[model samples]
Target: MAVRLPILLFRMGLGPAFGKRLLLLHHTGRATGLDRRVVLEVVAYEPNAGSWIVASGFGTRSDWYRNLRVEPKTVVQFGNRHHAVTARFLAADDGADIMARYGRRHPRTARRLCAFMKLPSDGSEASFRDAGRAIPFVRLDEARPRLP
Candidate 1:
């Protein structure tokens, strides 16, 4: 089956429980200078740190990630909530640490995430080590609720 089914469910307001937390992200394309909307999973939320973490499973090849790199300021929507924020690309070391912690806390989900990212299984330290290079992390900065 195509992964499109799961992605569709999320877009249609279902299946967020099954590893797809639908996120509506708005960014400006660097080359096109047009607004873009993307759906992504929410990897982690750190209220104390005032940031939310996301992973670019497609690495630098993903368009959304590339757009954010060119223009850090963007808008995000989680469920019914929306916010204006800045995106910060995490270093390889930091991404590894975050992936390690996530793998430890949610092994099964982590493994699934690894598979989705087309990386190796989460049970392998080698895989976790490789995630830094394979899957990069992004931090949402200066997040403020979007006005309805």
Candidate 2:
């Protein structure tokens, strides 16, 4: 229910408005080889590197995260643009840095996200870092030209 609505909106061509903040990830089932899709929030974007950072809010056990671990190649749709990208899991230390930086910009949302992820955090850098280390963060790097 929470994800179905956004998937519908993106399908109906309303994805561009959300742009880099949210993306639709297209991946394949590790065992089934069937296509799967999910809408995920963008934790951060690096313009120079053409990369988007995202986390498995449900931890590495999340289906999508597990699938990506089996096959790192995937596609991402942001707004009206689609890109072939590769997923790379970040190290715990790197995730901590990213979370700390994110907390500084969106403190409230960060707190809420931590709660939603069942991660304990008191808004301190250390807490956020610990929470980050507990979850899995992936960096999606553009692998090819934009899709039509």
Candidate 3:
């Protein structure tokens, strides 16, 4: 976890500059009532459709995802802007398809996905394919922006 701290801080700070693609997600612990925010790489957005898609590269092991399992509603922040969003956890089948598409568009992310999922990076398509299945994909429906 300590090794990941610097990377996490870097992502949290420069996320927006990377693109409109990175978003900061806030989730509240159902039991502890603690507010937690995580930086996620946003791979796709459908403005016309009014939705955005994100992937949990950390798979089901991520704390934020666990919090969401208990509390589906969350807050999202992107490029200095913030919104109250509802999280819809896509079914495993749908998540797999979305992750495949995401990997196709962002090959670099696919590599990171493999590492995050604890898959062997033998540089094989099969490894990547398996890694994709382990990650979790989510869609966010954001409401109007508001100050956090």
- Judged by lDDT, which candidate is best? 2
Ranking by TM-score: 2, 1, 3
TM-score of 2: 0.92
Name the lDDT value of residue 41 in candidate 3: 73
Q: In candidate 2, how many Å is residue 142 off?
A: 0.5
Report the CA-based lDDT of candidate 1 relative to the real structure. 0.74
**lDDT at 105, model 3:** 76
| Residue-by-residue lDDT tens digits, candidate 2, 1-148 | 8749888888899998786679999989998999999999999988667789998988988899999999999888888778889999999999999999989888998899999998899999889988888778999999853443
lDDT of each: 0.74, 0.89, 0.71
lDDT-based ranking, best first? 2, 1, 3
Query: For residues 1-148, could you state the per-residue lDDT of candidate 3 as single tens digits?
Result: 9745633654566555647767778899777999877777776787665567887766777888889988888787766566678888877667656656666777776777677677665545555556656667788887653334
lDDT of 1 at 23: 65
Work out the TM-score per prediction: 0.75, 0.92, 0.74
Judged by TM-score relative to the true structure, which candidate is superior, 1 or 3?
1
Candidate 3's error at 143, in angstroms? 3.6
Candidate 3 lowest-lDDT run of ten: 3-12
CA lDDT, candidate 3, residue 129:
55
**Cα-based RMSD of candidate 1:** 4.2
What is the C-alpha lDDT profile of model 1 across 1-148, one tens digit per residue? 4655644544576544443344667789889999877667777875555567888878888899999989998877655455678999988888888888877777787788788877777486557767655688998865653333
